[model samples]
Target: MEFNTKPDVVVIGELNVDIILNQIDAFPEIGKEILAQGMNITLGSSSAIFASNLCTLGSGVAFIGKIGKDSFASVVLESLNSKSVDTSHVIQSETVNTGATIVLNYDQDRAMVTYPGAMEDLRIEDIDFGFLSTARHLHFSSIFLQPGICEHLPELFSKAKSLGLTTSLDPQWDPAEKWEVDLSNLLPALDIFLPNKAEFLLLTGTSSMEEGIAMIKEIAPNLTLVIKDGSNGAYGWNYGKLVHQPAFLNTDVIDCIGAGDSFNAGFIHEFLKGSLLKKCLKTGALTGAVSTTRPGGTGAFDSVEGVSKIAAENFKMTL
Candidate 1:
Protein backbone atom coordinates (compact mmCIF):
# COMPACT_ATOMS: atom_id res chain seq x y z
CA MET A 1 0.00 0.00 0.00
CA GLU A 2 3.03 2.24 0.34
CA PHE A 3 4.02 3.94 -2.90
CA ASN A 4 7.44 5.32 -2.14
CA THR A 5 8.52 5.51 -5.77
CA LYS A 6 5.14 6.08 -7.37
CA PRO A 7 3.70 9.39 -8.43
CA ASP A 8 2.39 11.78 -5.78
CA VAL A 9 -0.91 12.09 -7.63
CA VAL A 10 -2.77 10.23 -10.36
CA VAL A 11 -5.22 12.29 -12.38
CA ILE A 12 -8.06 10.34 -13.96
CA GLY A 13 -10.37 12.37 -16.17
CA GLU A 14 -10.83 14.04 -19.59
CA LEU A 15 -8.18 15.03 -22.09
CA ASN A 16 -8.10 17.31 -25.15
CA VAL A 17 -6.45 20.22 -26.96
CA ASP A 18 -7.60 23.82 -26.73
CA ILE A 19 -7.78 26.22 -29.66
CA ILE A 20 -7.89 29.62 -27.98
CA LEU A 21 -9.11 32.65 -29.94
CA ASN A 22 -8.48 35.96 -28.23
CA GLN A 23 -8.99 39.75 -28.72
CA ILE A 24 -12.30 39.60 -30.50
CA ASP A 25 -13.93 42.94 -31.28
CA ALA A 26 -17.48 41.81 -30.61
CA PHE A 27 -19.52 38.72 -29.88
CA PRO A 28 -20.57 36.81 -32.96
CA GLU A 29 -24.16 37.31 -34.14
CA ILE A 30 -26.31 34.75 -35.94
CA GLY A 31 -25.18 35.75 -39.43
CA LYS A 32 -22.26 38.06 -38.76
CA GLU A 33 -18.64 36.91 -38.42
CA ILE A 34 -16.16 38.24 -35.91
CA LEU A 35 -12.39 38.67 -36.04
CA ALA A 36 -10.04 37.39 -33.35
CA GLN A 37 -6.66 39.08 -33.17
CA GLY A 38 -4.81 36.25 -31.45
CA MET A 39 -4.88 32.49 -31.40
CA ASN A 40 -2.97 29.62 -29.72
CA ILE A 41 -3.40 25.88 -29.50
CA THR A 42 -2.45 24.02 -26.32
CA LEU A 43 -3.33 21.05 -24.15
CA GLY A 44 -6.84 21.43 -22.75
CA SER A 45 -8.87 19.72 -20.00
CA SER A 46 -9.22 20.34 -16.29
CA SER A 47 -7.55 17.06 -15.35
CA ALA A 48 -4.64 17.43 -17.71
CA ILE A 49 -4.09 21.07 -16.72
CA PHE A 50 -4.13 20.12 -13.03
CA ALA A 51 -1.70 17.24 -13.57
CA SER A 52 0.69 19.26 -15.76
CA ASN A 53 0.70 22.28 -13.47
CA LEU A 54 0.95 20.14 -10.36
CA CYS A 55 3.97 18.37 -11.83
CA THR A 56 5.44 21.76 -12.63
CA LEU A 57 4.97 22.57 -8.94
CA GLY A 58 7.22 19.63 -7.92
CA SER A 59 4.63 16.87 -7.50
CA GLY A 60 5.27 13.52 -9.13
CA VAL A 61 2.15 13.39 -11.29
CA ALA A 62 0.69 10.82 -13.68
CA PHE A 63 -2.30 11.01 -16.02
CA ILE A 64 -4.95 8.51 -17.04
CA GLY A 65 -7.41 9.59 -19.72
CA LYS A 66 -8.57 8.78 -23.24
CA ILE A 67 -7.47 10.51 -26.39
CA GLY A 68 -7.47 9.64 -30.09
CA LYS A 69 -4.30 8.50 -31.79
CA ASP A 70 -4.15 11.65 -33.89
CA SER A 71 -2.35 15.00 -34.18
CA PHE A 72 -4.30 16.56 -31.33
CA ALA A 73 -3.46 13.58 -29.15
CA SER A 74 0.16 14.27 -29.98
CA VAL A 75 -0.33 17.80 -28.67
CA VAL A 76 -1.75 16.46 -25.43
CA LEU A 77 1.02 13.92 -24.93
CA GLU A 78 3.78 16.37 -25.78
CA SER A 79 2.31 19.01 -23.53
CA LEU A 80 2.14 16.64 -20.55
CA ASN A 81 5.55 15.23 -21.28
CA SER A 82 6.93 18.77 -21.53
CA LYS A 83 5.81 19.18 -17.93
CA SER A 84 7.48 15.86 -17.00
CA VAL A 85 4.13 14.29 -16.09
CA ASP A 86 3.78 10.56 -16.56
CA THR A 87 1.58 9.71 -19.57
CA SER A 88 2.23 5.98 -19.91
CA HIS A 89 -1.22 5.22 -18.48
CA VAL A 90 -3.09 7.37 -21.02
CA ILE A 91 -5.33 5.49 -23.41
CA GLN A 92 -5.37 6.08 -27.15
CA SER A 93 -8.33 5.13 -29.32
CA GLU A 94 -7.87 4.48 -33.00
CA THR A 95 -11.51 4.91 -34.00
CA VAL A 96 -12.45 7.91 -31.92
CA ASN A 97 -11.14 11.39 -32.65
CA THR A 98 -9.33 13.33 -29.96
CA GLY A 99 -11.39 15.88 -28.06
CA ALA A 100 -10.99 19.59 -28.70
CA THR A 101 -12.34 22.88 -27.37
CA ILE A 102 -12.61 26.13 -29.26
CA VAL A 103 -12.33 28.98 -26.73
CA LEU A 104 -13.47 32.50 -27.50
CA ASN A 105 -11.60 34.70 -25.03
CA TYR A 106 -12.90 38.14 -24.11
CA ASP A 107 -10.50 39.93 -21.78
CA GLN A 108 -11.36 38.41 -18.35
CA ASP A 109 -13.85 35.76 -19.46
CA ARG A 110 -14.44 33.32 -22.31
CA ALA A 111 -16.94 31.03 -23.96
CA MET A 112 -16.04 27.49 -24.98
CA VAL A 113 -17.45 24.92 -27.38
CA THR A 114 -16.21 21.37 -26.86
CA TYR A 115 -16.32 18.24 -28.96
CA PRO A 116 -16.14 15.50 -26.34
CA GLY A 117 -14.78 12.89 -28.77
CA ALA A 118 -12.83 10.12 -26.99
CA MET A 119 -13.36 11.79 -23.65
CA GLU A 120 -16.97 10.66 -23.68
CA ASP A 121 -15.82 7.08 -24.32
CA LEU A 122 -13.73 6.77 -21.16
CA ARG A 123 -15.66 4.32 -19.05
CA ILE A 124 -14.81 3.06 -15.57
CA GLU A 125 -13.89 -0.36 -16.94
CA ASP A 126 -10.92 1.17 -18.71
CA ILE A 127 -9.38 2.32 -15.44
CA ASP A 128 -6.46 0.26 -14.17
CA PHE A 129 -6.57 -0.28 -10.43
CA GLY A 130 -3.01 -1.58 -10.42
CA PHE A 131 -1.78 1.65 -11.93
CA LEU A 132 -3.96 3.70 -9.60
CA SER A 133 -2.44 1.97 -6.59
CA THR A 134 0.85 3.58 -7.53
CA ALA A 135 -0.29 7.06 -6.56
CA ARG A 136 -1.00 8.59 -3.15
CA HIS A 137 -3.89 10.76 -4.34
CA LEU A 138 -6.60 10.62 -7.01
CA HIS A 139 -8.05 13.71 -8.71
CA PHE A 140 -10.91 13.53 -11.24
CA SER A 141 -12.54 16.32 -13.18
CA SER A 142 -15.06 17.30 -15.87
CA ILE A 143 -17.70 14.84 -14.78
CA PHE A 144 -20.31 16.34 -17.11
CA LEU A 145 -18.17 15.89 -20.21
CA GLN A 146 -17.47 12.19 -19.67
CA PRO A 147 -20.83 10.43 -19.65
CA GLY A 148 -19.41 6.92 -19.75
CA ILE A 149 -17.80 7.33 -16.33
CA CYS A 150 -20.12 9.98 -14.97
CA GLU A 151 -22.81 7.70 -13.64
CA HIS A 152 -20.30 5.44 -11.90
CA LEU A 153 -18.46 8.23 -10.10
CA PRO A 154 -19.65 7.18 -6.66
CA GLU A 155 -18.50 3.63 -7.29
CA LEU A 156 -15.18 4.90 -8.63
CA PHE A 157 -14.52 7.13 -5.63
CA SER A 158 -15.58 4.40 -3.23
CA LYS A 159 -13.15 1.98 -4.84
CA ALA A 160 -10.34 4.51 -4.70
CA LYS A 161 -11.02 5.12 -1.03
CA SER A 162 -11.05 1.40 -0.40
CA LEU A 163 -7.61 1.27 -1.93
CA GLY A 164 -6.44 3.92 0.59
CA LEU A 165 -6.00 6.80 -1.86
CA THR A 166 -7.14 10.32 -0.97
CA THR A 167 -9.54 11.61 -3.61
CA SER A 168 -10.81 14.89 -5.06
CA LEU A 169 -13.32 15.82 -7.74
CA ASP A 170 -13.95 18.94 -9.78
CA PRO A 171 -17.36 18.83 -11.38
CA GLN A 172 -16.99 21.32 -14.16
CA TRP A 173 -19.96 22.93 -15.86
CA ASP A 174 -22.55 20.62 -17.31
CA PRO A 175 -23.28 21.54 -20.90
CA ALA A 176 -26.51 19.55 -20.72
CA GLU A 177 -27.75 21.91 -17.92
CA LYS A 178 -29.36 18.94 -16.19
CA TRP A 179 -26.63 18.84 -13.48
CA GLU A 180 -27.43 15.21 -12.89
CA VAL A 181 -24.78 13.59 -10.70
CA ASP A 182 -25.95 11.94 -7.44
CA LEU A 183 -24.02 14.01 -4.91
CA SER A 184 -25.49 12.24 -1.87
CA ASN A 185 -23.89 9.00 -3.00
CA LEU A 186 -20.65 10.59 -4.24
CA LEU A 187 -19.56 13.20 -1.66
CA PRO A 188 -19.06 10.88 1.34
CA ALA A 189 -16.46 8.89 -0.58
CA LEU A 190 -14.65 11.96 -1.85
CA ASP A 191 -12.21 13.80 0.42
CA ILE A 192 -12.41 17.08 -1.44
CA PHE A 193 -15.02 18.58 -3.74
CA LEU A 194 -13.86 21.62 -5.74
CA PRO A 195 -16.48 23.57 -7.64
CA ASN A 196 -16.60 27.12 -8.80
CA LYS A 197 -19.37 29.36 -7.41
CA ALA A 198 -21.70 28.99 -10.37
CA GLU A 199 -21.15 25.23 -10.56
CA PHE A 200 -21.73 24.87 -6.80
CA LEU A 201 -24.97 26.85 -7.12
CA LEU A 202 -26.23 24.72 -10.00
CA LEU A 203 -25.14 21.38 -8.55
CA THR A 204 -26.43 22.07 -5.06
CA GLY A 205 -29.67 23.69 -6.37
CA THR A 206 -29.22 26.53 -3.90
CA SER A 207 -29.57 30.25 -4.49
CA SER A 208 -26.81 31.43 -2.16
CA MET A 209 -23.44 30.19 -0.80
CA GLU A 210 -24.78 29.69 2.74
CA GLU A 211 -27.63 27.54 1.50
CA GLY A 212 -25.34 25.48 -0.70
CA ILE A 213 -22.87 24.98 2.16
CA ALA A 214 -25.64 23.85 4.50
CA MET A 215 -27.00 21.43 1.90
CA ILE A 216 -23.59 19.92 1.16
CA LYS A 217 -22.84 19.57 4.88
CA GLU A 218 -26.08 17.71 5.34
CA ILE A 219 -25.09 15.31 2.57
CA ALA A 220 -21.46 14.80 3.65
CA PRO A 221 -20.56 16.53 6.88
CA ASN A 222 -16.89 15.49 6.77
CA LEU A 223 -16.33 16.45 3.15
CA THR A 224 -14.05 19.40 2.44
CA LEU A 225 -15.82 21.77 0.10
CA VAL A 226 -13.85 24.41 -1.76
CA ILE A 227 -15.76 26.99 -3.76
CA LYS A 228 -13.70 28.84 -6.34
CA ASP A 229 -15.08 32.41 -6.52
CA GLY A 230 -13.38 34.24 -9.36
CA SER A 231 -12.27 37.85 -8.67
CA ASN A 232 -13.87 37.74 -5.21
CA GLY A 233 -11.73 34.80 -3.97
CA ALA A 234 -12.13 31.18 -2.82
CA TYR A 235 -14.16 29.78 0.07
CA GLY A 236 -13.34 26.60 1.99
CA TRP A 237 -15.50 24.58 4.38
CA ASN A 238 -13.28 22.37 6.46
CA TYR A 239 -13.48 21.12 10.08
CA GLY A 240 -17.00 22.55 10.37
CA LYS A 241 -15.86 26.13 9.69
CA LEU A 242 -15.77 28.47 6.70
CA VAL A 243 -12.52 30.04 5.47
CA HIS A 244 -12.03 32.56 2.67
CA GLN A 245 -8.96 33.27 0.58
CA PRO A 246 -9.10 36.38 -1.56
CA ALA A 247 -8.02 36.28 -5.17
CA PHE A 248 -4.52 37.52 -5.97
CA LEU A 249 -5.80 40.02 -8.50
CA ASN A 250 -4.01 40.42 -11.82
CA THR A 251 -5.04 43.56 -13.73
CA ASP A 252 -2.99 42.80 -16.86
CA VAL A 253 -4.32 39.30 -17.34
CA ILE A 254 -3.81 37.73 -20.74
CA ASP A 255 -6.64 35.22 -20.33
CA CYS A 256 -8.58 33.35 -17.67
CA ILE A 257 -8.14 29.92 -19.25
CA GLY A 258 -7.37 27.05 -16.84
CA ALA A 259 -7.17 29.36 -13.87
CA GLY A 260 -9.50 27.23 -11.77
CA ASP A 261 -7.68 24.03 -12.65
CA SER A 262 -4.44 25.74 -11.73
CA PHE A 263 -6.03 26.67 -8.44
CA ASN A 264 -6.92 23.03 -7.84
CA ALA A 265 -3.38 22.02 -8.66
CA GLY A 266 -1.92 24.46 -6.17
CA PHE A 267 -4.36 23.48 -3.47
CA ILE A 268 -3.77 19.76 -3.95
CA HIS A 269 -0.04 20.37 -4.07
CA GLU A 270 -0.15 21.95 -0.63
CA PHE A 271 -2.76 19.54 0.68
CA LEU A 272 -0.60 16.53 -0.14
CA LYS A 273 2.26 18.26 1.65
CA GLY A 274 0.24 18.59 4.88
CA SER A 275 -0.05 22.37 4.72
CA LEU A 276 -2.78 24.17 6.62
CA LEU A 277 -6.11 24.81 4.94
CA LYS A 278 -5.43 28.54 4.85
CA LYS A 279 -2.02 28.01 3.25
CA CYS A 280 -3.54 25.68 0.70
CA LEU A 281 -6.17 28.25 -0.21
CA LYS A 282 -3.54 31.00 -0.45
CA THR A 283 -1.40 28.82 -2.70
CA GLY A 284 -4.44 28.07 -4.81
CA ALA A 285 -5.29 31.74 -5.19
CA LEU A 286 -1.70 32.66 -6.04
CA THR A 287 -1.34 29.96 -8.65
CA GLY A 288 -4.71 30.83 -10.14
CA ALA A 289 -3.63 34.45 -10.47
CA VAL A 290 -0.28 33.38 -11.93
CA SER A 291 -2.12 31.35 -14.59
CA THR A 292 -3.92 34.45 -15.91
CA THR A 293 -0.61 36.20 -16.70
CA ARG A 294 0.14 33.84 -19.58
CA PRO A 295 -1.61 32.64 -22.71
CA GLY A 296 -2.96 29.32 -21.46
CA GLY A 297 -3.07 27.27 -18.27
CA THR A 298 0.31 25.62 -18.61
CA GLY A 299 2.13 28.57 -20.14
CA ALA A 300 2.94 30.40 -16.92
CA PHE A 301 3.78 27.14 -15.14
CA ASP A 302 6.99 26.19 -16.88
CA SER A 303 8.90 25.85 -13.60
CA VAL A 304 8.39 26.46 -9.90
CA GLU A 305 11.14 29.07 -9.95
CA GLY A 306 9.50 30.81 -12.88
CA VAL A 307 6.16 30.78 -11.12
CA SER A 308 7.77 32.09 -7.95
CA LYS A 309 9.30 34.96 -9.90
CA ILE A 310 5.94 35.85 -11.42
CA ALA A 311 4.29 35.57 -8.02
CA ALA A 312 6.83 37.97 -6.54
CA GLU A 313 6.88 40.46 -9.38
CA ASN A 314 3.28 40.47 -10.53
CA PHE A 315 1.36 39.52 -7.43
CA LYS A 316 3.81 40.64 -4.72
CA MET A 317 3.74 37.23 -3.10
CA THR A 318 6.58 34.73 -2.83
CA LEU A 319 5.60 31.17 -3.55
Candidate 2:
Protein backbone atom coordinates (compact mmCIF):
# COMPACT_ATOMS: atom_id res chain seq x y z
CA MET A 1 0.00 0.00 0.00
CA GLU A 2 2.91 2.35 -0.61
CA PHE A 3 1.91 5.57 -2.38
CA ASN A 4 3.48 8.87 -3.33
CA THR A 5 4.12 10.90 -0.20
CA LYS A 6 5.44 14.08 -1.79
CA PRO A 7 2.50 16.36 -0.95
CA ASP A 8 2.13 18.04 2.39
CA VAL A 9 -1.62 18.41 2.14
CA VAL A 10 -4.32 16.71 0.09
CA VAL A 11 -7.65 18.54 -0.27
CA ILE A 12 -10.71 16.65 -1.50
CA GLY A 13 -13.78 18.79 -1.91
CA GLU A 14 -15.81 21.01 -4.24
CA LEU A 15 -14.57 23.15 -7.13
CA ASN A 16 -16.19 26.02 -9.05
CA VAL A 17 -15.89 29.53 -10.52
CA ASP A 18 -17.05 32.78 -9.02
CA ILE A 19 -18.67 35.45 -11.18
CA ILE A 20 -18.36 38.54 -9.01
CA LEU A 21 -20.39 41.64 -9.75
CA ASN A 22 -19.07 44.57 -7.78
CA GLN A 23 -20.57 48.01 -7.11
CA ILE A 24 -24.01 46.97 -8.14
CA ASP A 25 -26.49 49.82 -8.21
CA ALA A 26 -29.22 47.61 -6.78
CA PHE A 27 -30.09 44.01 -6.12
CA PRO A 28 -31.66 42.21 -9.04
CA GLU A 29 -35.45 42.14 -8.88
CA ILE A 30 -37.99 39.80 -10.45
CA GLY A 31 -38.63 42.00 -13.49
CA LYS A 32 -36.14 44.83 -13.17
CA GLU A 33 -32.58 44.90 -14.35
CA ILE A 34 -29.62 46.17 -12.34
CA LEU A 35 -26.25 47.55 -13.25
CA ALA A 36 -22.85 46.59 -11.87
CA GLN A 37 -19.72 48.66 -12.23
CA GLY A 38 -17.37 45.71 -12.48
CA MET A 39 -17.33 41.95 -12.90
CA ASN A 40 -14.65 39.29 -12.56
CA ILE A 41 -14.68 35.56 -13.20
CA THR A 42 -12.30 33.82 -10.81
CA LEU A 43 -11.65 30.34 -9.44
CA GLY A 44 -14.28 30.00 -6.75
CA SER A 45 -14.52 27.17 -4.24
CA SER A 46 -13.48 27.02 -0.58
CA SER A 47 -11.37 23.87 -1.04
CA ALA A 48 -9.68 25.26 -4.14
CA ILE A 49 -8.91 28.48 -2.35
CA PHE A 50 -7.40 26.54 0.55
CA ALA A 51 -5.23 24.45 -1.79
CA SER A 52 -4.11 27.40 -3.91
CA ASN A 53 -3.31 29.61 -0.95
CA LEU A 54 -1.68 26.79 0.96
CA CYS A 55 0.62 26.18 -2.01
CA THR A 56 1.26 29.93 -2.25
CA LEU A 57 2.27 29.85 1.40
CA GLY A 58 4.99 27.28 0.63
CA SER A 59 3.28 23.93 1.06
CA GLY A 60 3.25 20.97 -1.30
CA VAL A 61 -0.48 20.70 -1.92
CA ALA A 62 -2.74 18.55 -4.12
CA PHE A 63 -6.44 18.72 -4.96
CA ILE A 64 -9.12 16.04 -5.47
CA GLY A 65 -12.57 16.96 -6.70
CA LYS A 66 -14.92 16.86 -9.66
CA ILE A 67 -15.20 19.42 -12.46
CA GLY A 68 -16.77 19.34 -15.91
CA LYS A 69 -14.80 19.12 -19.14
CA ASP A 70 -15.69 22.68 -20.02
CA SER A 71 -14.04 26.09 -20.21
CA PHE A 72 -14.75 26.60 -16.53
CA ALA A 73 -12.79 23.45 -15.80
CA SER A 74 -9.84 24.96 -17.60
CA VAL A 75 -10.11 28.04 -15.42
CA VAL A 76 -10.07 25.90 -12.29
CA LEU A 77 -7.06 23.87 -13.47
CA GLU A 78 -5.18 26.99 -14.57
CA SER A 79 -5.70 28.74 -11.27
CA LEU A 80 -4.62 25.78 -9.17
CA ASN A 81 -1.76 24.80 -11.46
CA SER A 82 -0.39 28.34 -11.52
CA LYS A 83 -0.16 28.18 -7.75
CA SER A 84 1.83 24.90 -7.92
CA VAL A 85 -0.99 22.71 -6.62
CA ASP A 86 -1.04 19.24 -8.14
CA THR A 87 -4.35 18.81 -10.00
CA SER A 88 -3.79 15.28 -11.31
CA HIS A 89 -6.41 13.86 -8.98
CA VAL A 90 -9.13 16.30 -10.06
CA ILE A 91 -11.76 14.34 -11.95
CA GLN A 92 -13.23 16.01 -15.01
CA SER A 93 -16.72 14.65 -15.59
CA GLU A 94 -18.35 15.01 -19.00
CA THR A 95 -21.86 14.33 -17.71
CA VAL A 96 -22.09 17.47 -15.51
CA ASN A 97 -21.17 21.11 -15.93
CA THR A 98 -18.73 22.89 -13.66
CA GLY A 99 -20.15 24.69 -10.64
CA ALA A 100 -20.24 28.50 -10.37
CA THR A 101 -21.26 31.21 -7.94
CA ILE A 102 -22.74 34.59 -8.85
CA VAL A 103 -21.55 37.03 -6.17
CA LEU A 104 -22.94 40.54 -5.80
CA ASN A 105 -20.52 42.46 -3.65
CA TYR A 106 -21.92 45.33 -1.60
CA ASP A 107 -19.20 46.86 0.55
CA GLN A 108 -18.40 44.39 3.37
CA ASP A 109 -21.37 42.13 2.75
CA ARG A 110 -22.61 40.39 -0.37
CA ALA A 111 -25.20 38.03 -1.80
CA MET A 112 -24.47 34.88 -3.77
CA VAL A 113 -26.20 32.24 -5.89
CA THR A 114 -24.29 29.02 -6.56
CA TYR A 115 -24.93 26.33 -9.15
CA PRO A 116 -23.70 23.15 -7.45
CA GLY A 117 -23.38 21.25 -10.76
CA ALA A 118 -20.40 18.87 -10.55
CA MET A 119 -19.74 19.76 -6.92
CA GLU A 120 -22.62 17.56 -5.82
CA ASP A 121 -21.38 14.69 -7.95
CA LEU A 122 -18.14 13.93 -6.06
CA ARG A 123 -18.72 10.79 -4.05
CA ILE A 124 -16.79 8.35 -1.85
CA GLU A 125 -16.41 6.10 -4.88
CA ASP A 126 -14.81 8.93 -6.82
CA ILE A 127 -11.93 9.32 -4.34
CA ASP A 128 -8.59 7.57 -4.77
CA PHE A 129 -7.44 6.08 -1.47
CA GLY A 130 -3.97 5.58 -2.93
CA PHE A 131 -3.87 9.31 -3.51
CA LEU A 132 -4.92 9.89 0.10
CA SER A 133 -1.83 8.02 1.36
CA THR A 134 0.46 10.20 -0.72
CA ALA A 135 -0.09 13.30 1.40
CA ARG A 136 0.95 13.96 4.97
CA HIS A 137 -2.42 15.49 5.79
CA LEU A 138 -5.97 15.58 4.49
CA HIS A 139 -8.36 18.55 4.58
CA PHE A 140 -11.97 18.67 3.37
CA SER A 141 -14.47 21.50 3.22
CA SER A 142 -17.94 22.56 2.07
CA ILE A 143 -19.69 19.41 3.17
CA PHE A 144 -23.15 20.81 2.46
CA LEU A 145 -22.44 21.40 -1.20
CA GLN A 146 -21.55 17.75 -1.94
CA PRO A 147 -24.46 15.49 -1.07
CA GLY A 148 -22.84 12.30 -2.33
CA ILE A 149 -19.78 12.76 -0.12
CA CYS A 150 -21.66 14.12 2.88
CA GLU A 151 -22.99 10.79 4.16
CA HIS A 152 -20.08 8.39 3.52
CA LEU A 153 -17.14 10.82 3.74
CA PRO A 154 -16.18 9.24 7.03
CA GLU A 155 -15.08 6.23 5.05
CA LEU A 156 -12.57 8.48 3.36
CA PHE A 157 -11.47 10.16 6.58
CA SER A 158 -11.10 6.83 8.31
CA LYS A 159 -9.09 5.56 5.40
CA ALA A 160 -6.86 8.61 5.57
CA LYS A 161 -6.32 8.06 9.28
CA SER A 162 -5.58 4.38 8.81
CA LEU A 163 -3.06 5.42 6.17
CA GLY A 164 -1.26 7.67 8.69
CA LEU A 165 -2.69 10.96 7.42
CA THR A 166 -3.67 13.73 9.77
CA THR A 167 -7.06 15.21 8.91
CA SER A 168 -8.92 18.52 9.19
CA LEU A 169 -12.34 19.66 8.03
CA ASP A 170 -14.13 22.94 7.56
CA PRO A 171 -17.83 22.31 7.59
CA GLN A 172 -18.92 25.46 5.85
CA TRP A 173 -22.44 26.83 6.15
CA ASP A 174 -25.06 24.20 5.46
CA PRO A 175 -27.77 25.79 3.34
CA ALA A 176 -30.32 23.31 4.63
CA GLU A 177 -29.53 24.15 8.29
CA LYS A 178 -30.06 20.47 9.00
CA TRP A 179 -26.41 19.92 10.12
CA GLU A 180 -27.13 16.26 9.54
CA VAL A 181 -23.64 14.68 9.51
CA ASP A 182 -23.11 12.33 12.44
CA LEU A 183 -20.12 13.67 14.37
CA SER A 184 -19.96 10.62 16.63
CA ASN A 185 -18.31 8.60 13.88
CA LEU A 186 -16.73 11.60 12.16
CA LEU A 187 -15.00 13.33 15.08
CA PRO A 188 -13.11 10.20 16.11
CA ALA A 189 -11.51 10.09 12.67
CA LEU A 190 -10.52 13.76 12.56
CA ASP A 191 -7.50 15.32 14.25
CA ILE A 192 -8.58 18.88 13.61
CA PHE A 193 -12.00 20.42 13.01
CA LEU A 194 -12.04 24.01 11.71
CA PRO A 195 -15.35 25.86 11.75
CA ASN A 196 -16.34 29.49 12.03
CA LYS A 197 -18.12 30.89 15.07
CA ALA A 198 -21.57 30.60 13.53
CA GLU A 199 -20.93 27.23 11.95
CA PHE A 200 -19.55 25.85 15.20
CA LEU A 201 -22.62 27.05 17.05
CA LEU A 202 -25.03 25.60 14.55
CA LEU A 203 -23.08 22.38 14.07
CA THR A 204 -23.03 21.67 17.77
CA GLY A 205 -26.50 23.18 18.40
CA THR A 206 -25.07 25.35 21.12
CA SER A 207 -25.87 28.96 21.97
CA SER A 208 -22.22 29.95 22.57
CA MET A 209 -18.78 28.98 21.33
CA GLU A 210 -17.77 27.67 24.75
CA GLU A 211 -20.85 25.47 24.81
CA GLY A 212 -20.10 24.09 21.38
CA ILE A 213 -16.49 23.35 22.31
CA ALA A 214 -17.68 21.54 25.41
CA MET A 215 -20.06 19.37 23.40
CA ILE A 216 -17.49 18.31 20.81
CA LYS A 217 -14.73 17.93 23.38
CA GLU A 218 -17.00 15.63 25.28
CA ILE A 219 -16.93 13.24 22.33
CA ALA A 220 -13.36 13.77 21.18
CA PRO A 221 -11.42 15.63 23.85
CA ASN A 222 -8.07 15.30 22.10
CA LEU A 223 -9.25 16.88 18.86
CA THR A 224 -7.93 20.29 17.92
CA LEU A 225 -10.84 22.66 17.38
CA VAL A 226 -10.34 26.04 15.75
CA ILE A 227 -13.32 28.37 15.48
CA LYS A 228 -12.90 31.49 13.36
CA ASP A 229 -14.70 34.69 14.41
CA GLY A 230 -14.92 37.56 11.92
CA SER A 231 -13.48 40.53 13.83
CA ASN A 232 -12.92 39.01 17.24
CA GLY A 233 -10.28 36.66 15.82
CA ALA A 234 -9.91 32.85 16.19
CA TYR A 235 -10.17 30.48 19.14
CA GLY A 236 -8.51 27.08 19.44
CA TRP A 237 -9.05 24.26 21.87
CA ASN A 238 -6.50 21.48 22.18
CA TYR A 239 -5.36 19.07 24.90
CA GLY A 240 -8.30 20.30 27.02
CA LYS A 241 -6.97 23.89 26.98
CA LEU A 242 -8.34 26.89 25.06
CA VAL A 243 -6.08 29.32 23.20
CA HIS A 244 -7.07 32.62 21.61
CA GLN A 245 -5.48 34.49 18.71
CA PRO A 246 -6.72 37.96 17.82
CA ALA A 247 -7.13 38.78 14.15
CA PHE A 248 -4.72 41.05 12.30
CA LEU A 249 -6.95 43.99 11.49
CA ASN A 250 -7.09 45.20 7.91
CA THR A 251 -8.69 48.65 8.01
CA ASP A 252 -8.63 48.99 4.24
CA VAL A 253 -10.30 45.88 2.90
CA ILE A 254 -11.33 45.16 -0.65
CA ASP A 255 -13.63 42.28 0.24
CA CYS A 256 -13.85 39.38 2.70
CA ILE A 257 -14.53 36.75 0.06
CA GLY A 258 -12.17 33.87 0.96
CA ALA A 259 -11.02 34.96 4.39
CA GLY A 260 -11.97 31.72 6.11
CA ASP A 261 -10.37 29.54 3.48
CA SER A 262 -7.25 31.68 3.67
CA PHE A 263 -7.21 31.18 7.41
CA ASN A 264 -7.47 27.42 6.92
CA ALA A 265 -4.56 27.54 4.48
CA GLY A 266 -2.33 29.41 6.87
CA PHE A 267 -3.23 27.23 9.80
CA ILE A 268 -2.68 24.04 7.85
CA HIS A 269 0.61 25.27 6.48
CA GLU A 270 1.89 26.03 9.96
CA PHE A 271 0.37 22.87 11.42
CA LEU A 272 2.08 20.71 8.83
CA LYS A 273 5.36 22.38 9.78
CA GLY A 274 4.83 21.22 13.36
CA SER A 275 4.54 24.76 14.62
CA LEU A 276 3.12 25.53 18.04
CA LEU A 277 -0.65 25.60 18.41
CA LYS A 278 -0.73 29.32 19.27
CA LYS A 279 1.59 30.15 16.38
CA CYS A 280 -0.63 28.29 13.95
CA LEU A 281 -3.60 30.25 15.24
CA LYS A 282 -1.75 33.55 14.83
CA THR A 283 -0.53 32.70 11.33
CA GLY A 284 -4.03 31.65 10.33
CA ALA A 285 -5.45 34.94 11.56
CA LEU A 286 -2.73 36.96 9.83
CA THR A 287 -3.31 35.16 6.53
CA GLY A 288 -7.06 35.65 6.87
CA ALA A 289 -6.49 39.38 7.37
CA VAL A 290 -4.16 39.47 4.40
CA SER A 291 -6.96 38.00 2.29
CA THR A 292 -9.18 41.04 3.00
CA THR A 293 -6.53 43.48 1.76
CA ARG A 294 -7.26 42.24 -1.75
CA PRO A 295 -10.32 41.75 -3.96
CA GLY A 296 -10.69 37.96 -3.96
CA GLY A 297 -9.51 35.08 -1.74
CA THR A 298 -6.21 34.23 -3.44
CA GLY A 299 -5.29 37.83 -4.29
CA ALA A 300 -3.29 38.49 -1.11
CA PHE A 301 -1.50 35.16 -1.37
CA ASP A 302 -0.13 35.42 -4.90
CA SER A 303 3.34 34.46 -3.66
CA VAL A 304 5.17 33.57 -0.49
CA GLU A 305 7.24 36.73 -0.75
CA GLY A 306 4.14 38.79 -1.47
CA VAL A 307 2.34 37.42 1.56
CA SER A 308 5.45 37.77 3.73
CA LYS A 309 5.90 41.40 2.62
CA ILE A 310 2.22 42.13 3.38
CA ALA A 311 2.41 40.43 6.76
CA ALA A 312 5.36 42.56 7.80
CA GLU A 313 4.16 45.82 6.25
CA ASN A 314 0.44 45.71 7.03
CA PHE A 315 0.30 43.54 10.13
CA LYS A 316 3.82 44.37 11.45
CA MET A 317 4.47 40.60 11.61
CA THR A 318 6.21 37.89 9.61
CA LEU A 319 4.73 34.66 8.30
Query: Which candidate gets the maximum TM-score versus the true structure?
Result: 2
lDDT of 2 by residue, 112-228 (tens): 899999999998988888877878999999999999888887788889999999999999999989988778778888999999998888888889987887788788887999999
Taking the tens digit of each residue's C-alpha lDDT, what string does model 1 give over 208-245? 99999989888899899999998888999987899999
**CA displacement after TM-score superposition, residue 75 of candidate 2 (Å):** 0.9
lDDT of 1: 0.91
- What range of 10 consecutive residues in model 1 has the weakest lDDT sum? 1-10
Which is the leading candidate under lDDT?
A: 1
For candidate 2, report its TM-score.
0.94
The clash count of every prediction, one per candidate, is 0, 0
Q: What are the lDDT figures for the candidates, one per model?
A: 0.91, 0.90
The alpha-carbon deviation from the true structure for residue 153 of candidate 2, after best TM-score superposition, in angstroms, is 1.9
The positional error of residue 291 in candidate 2, measured at the CA in angstroms, is 1.1
Model 2: lowest-lDDT 10 consecutive positions: 1-10
